[model samples]
Target chain A: MSLAASPAPAFTLYDYVLSGNCYKIRLAAALLGVPYDSIAVDFYPGFEHRSEAMLALNPAGTLPVMKTADGVVLTETNAMLAWLGLNHDPGGRWYPAADPVRGPRLVEAMSFGAGLTGSVGLARLHAMLDWPVDGAAARRAGKRDLRQLELRLTAMQIDGEDWLAGGTAPSMADLACFPYVALSPDAGLDHDGYPAIRSWLYRVRSLPGFVTMPGIHDLHELR
Target chain B: MSLAASPAPAFTLYDYVLSGNCYKIRLAAALLGVPYDSIAVDFYPGFEHRSEAMLALNPAGTLPVMKTADGVVLTETNAMLAWLGLNHDPGGRWYPAADPVRGPRLVEAMSFGAGLTGSVGLARLHAMLDWPVDGAAARRAGKRDLRQLELRLTAMQIDGEDWLAGGTAPSMADLACFPYVALSPDAGLDHDGYPAIRSWLYRVRSLPGFVTMPGIHDLHELR
Candidate 1:
């Protein structure tokens, strides 16, 4: 991790080891080589995140809070990733730093990242763990969302853009969407059905600084 | 609706009047004084957003597609709002174009706008209109979501940030969250329990350039 010439920032990440939502920040941190401590939040310990301290850090009560040396608390995975990519990178190239031409596209990708990726995440939550998701109904929703994903992937392919919202360089949008798309099949989605999307996923996975989401079993395997 | 310096842009907004999601962009346009042509998308036509044309504009079939004059289409309400607020505004005060300190907080507020306001939208969809949400278990799901919404509102009150993120000046985050939170009671949520959120709603409504969402009874209401 490159220490800022000014001073080392007291950085820490509050994360759950198995969470891809948390993993997004970890991956960005690794890619950027930013040093930070990690504190695990036990979600299963009866809503431990609902505790007062966690709430103070994040009223949303979600994981992946990155505390800066100056004492600012950052929440929301994408928001944190955007900051690290924008603020820490020496090259200013991790994510497009807001171009007049492509800025809007970046935001579109993020909206899909949050909404579409969120749908896939919930579908998997129901599929694997038998959470509160309605059985067949959840799959129906997944199928619908998958169609949207396919169309989005196709448009990027058709738009002939090398990467999402920027050519040749990877942006935070790519990082934001990559994981959920990579694990689409776990939610009953078939990548074979969306060839362009499959290609896009491979492209994201092959990035020079890429990191995979803790290998699925890391949650059970790590500890 | 200010005229462009040259020919007008090819802007198309796939919007529903009562939707806070679409309102995000419209609010930005009003603040920036940009004229955009509105195309009413029928949500009741079995998720008309799933149509091929809409998908071509946005793979996720989301609303508020602001296509530029040169054929570049921008989706994602917040991103579109940010782009216009930054690029089109001469003063660039709407988004505070270059202040890194305030940017992330605004982005965080935008994310919270999505999930938090989205829950309110869901409540309206399920409780008020009694729409058959594709997930068959959605009825029960709605109540659970409402409980979560109450908690979120309570936390927002506790945080007590002046304008959703920080500072007295409002940004896209406040605009993004306005419609759904304002109309949440129409969906059966009692804001009487969340005094702070209730006040926040009024604060958003009081913004200088804010425009009310069109009435359903009016011909141009959906625009």
Candidate 2:
């Protein structure tokens, strides 16, 4: 893995490795070539995210709380990705949307990311984290979401586009939707039907400086 | 209802009157004094939102689909709110706070809104729309979400702020999080514990050009 060049990145992310939300942040930082300290929060059995210190940091008790160098604390992983894309990337490469159009589309993807996280991601929790989710309901929802995503990707491909929001550049739209989707199998979602989405995942992994979690295979490392 | 001055807003919102997501668009447009044509999409037993036309508009089969003057279509309510705030409000009054901070905070609120929608909003659907949600679990999660909102609002109020994300003026974050929260009672969540959020909702209603849905009573009308 590529490391930060000079002084340590002033970002500190309170994270849980198994969390897709947390993974998005790590992915963004890795892609940006920025390094941040990761303090693992035991989200599964221990559920330390609800502890006093964690709640004091973010009352919502959500994982992947990020403390920027300026001491500004933020929860919501996609928001952190957005802040990093907007502030840290001087070239604005990660957020290549031209606005009014691409911007709203990115927002749409982020919102869908939320739905996918709740359904597919929640379904995964039942298996790996001992969290009991409504199996049938979550599976149904996850399948529906996959179809929707596949449909969008198919349309984008028809339009001769590869990325989700931006034209040629991969944006937060891609990152926000990636982890849980790549990990949807843990949720019992069959991947055989989503060819376009699978291809898109490969493209995301092949980006210049991509990273990976346990379930998300790093394309470079595999090859 | 205030209508837009001549040369109509080229916006078209496919909405359901009872939908909080749809109400968010009405609220934003009302607050902005921008008028749009509303095309009601029967979301209840009819489920026309999933019809071929609606699916063509938004493959996600979600409501509050918006067709902008530029013909760009959007489905997510909060994204529509953000798009309207970013584009329509030339003064940037609705998208307050500097980037890198307020932006992330707004995103956090939007994500929290998603949770609240699933919890409190889902509870309401069981009654109004005959949607069979997990009642006990939803109520429990709804109450927890309310408490979290209460805590955040209390902190923001103590910080001498009335709105959710911005310093003083109401922003899209407030609008995005407001509808379902104000209408939580329909979901069997008691309002007694969330005084700060309650007061904050009133402040939102008191804003100039504020609009209301069925359950969300207008403060001005009450007095």
Candidate 3:
């Protein structure tokens, strides 16, 4: 389960250890058993992601920039997730982009995950790193978003659906959303108010090959 | 190219005539020649999109909700575009979600387009409908986004690619981004400074079945 560098990996990820977005790629690669090389960047104190070299790789100056062995660069986290799912998973369950019903739903959940980035993600950055964002506004938005997510998760639970896109197996949608929602406590938004989200987070962590990030830990061995 | 109601349309689109997000759906349907019934919701002044009825359909309270005849509802515009492209377009050029290379790029551009909804789209809403957003901040972000788009478009043009995802034909990426960038003038961001964006807009408008919204117009008959 170790992500130690392979002699020759398929992808190279420019990652930040504390970033949920970056952890998403790492966790997805781990769960799918896809090997990749990781080059750590200091996003907080160093702001290396915004440096000229990083910007050359990803003009958006975002973390979790992924480059394939063939020189294809992916700057968006969801896009990177899609690429990993579509290319690596032999069973095609991870992406399922060709499934007419599930594909759009997957895309929908992925977009919702990006919304979480602006809300919970921003609030976390502000709280942890004192990033120059409107912390109060971000927390407000994050609370609203978490509430909405809880409602959806409750509905899905009622419908007997275990995944966000209502598929038998978790897709990129789950991977896209898992990190931020799992890390919401760092933003001062605790899971006590979101039972369904807590359950979903537990299920995600219980998955085989699940990896841990700074704020989110792997499930206890006894559990 | 007329979008007049069919006796039995395959889908129903909850629409707002002036909304750039809604236009993204209408334009995608038109480009793919997919027939749909339009249910207009008064977004401005009325805020019908937030009304109880629309809330029952889309809790997100966003315009451009699409329901398939089979009763599948798509709340995200990019997801709706993906559904239309994946389901309607026989050639599959519009989605290309199965392509290892193009699929990721398409998702990346689509994500970028959603960012436009925050920047250019918010600024436009502030200017046109006085939506009570931070017009100044929205404008600043809009300018930055437009500049980034221009740089990418310039690079694409240099590489002899006509579309956003670097595909031979336009994909959902192009449609997802076309509306906001085309409507940037409403936000006080003109195309005079971005030659590459201007050309890309022209190319998009020149597509065979391009439709027009309030702020965007079709090419003249002579053209």
* lDDT, candidate 3, at B50: 95
Worst 10 residues of 2 chain B by lDDT: B95-104
Best by the TM-score measure? 3
Candidate 1 lDDT for residue A124? 72
- Cα lDDT tens digits for candidate 3, A85-146: 87888888889887888889889999999889999999999999899999999999999989
Over A85-183, each residue of candidate 1 has an lDDT whose tens digit, in order, gives 667787877656356666666766766676654577777767666768665666666677666666766766676776776566777777777666666
Query: By lDDT, highest first, what's the ranking?
Result: 3, 2, 1
Clashes of 3: 0
Query: Docking category for candidate 3?
Result: high
Cα deviation at A171, candidate 2, in Å, is: 0.9
The local distance difference test score of each candidate is: 0.67, 0.81, 0.89
Interface RMSD, model 3, angstroms = 0.8
Residue runs of model 1 more than 4 Å from their true location after superposition: A1-10, A44-56, A143-147, A188-190, A216-223, B1-10, B42-62, B96-98, B134-161, B214-223
The order by descending DockQ is 3, 2, 1
- lDDT of each residue in B1-223, candidate 3, tens digit only: 9786645787999998988889999998888888889999999889899999999998989888999999998899989988997788888788887778888988999999988999999999999888888999999999999999999988888778989988568889999999999999999999999999988898899999889988886788426
Q: Report model 2's interface C-alpha RMSD after superposition on the true interface residues.
A: 2.6
DockQ of each: 0.44, 0.51, 0.80
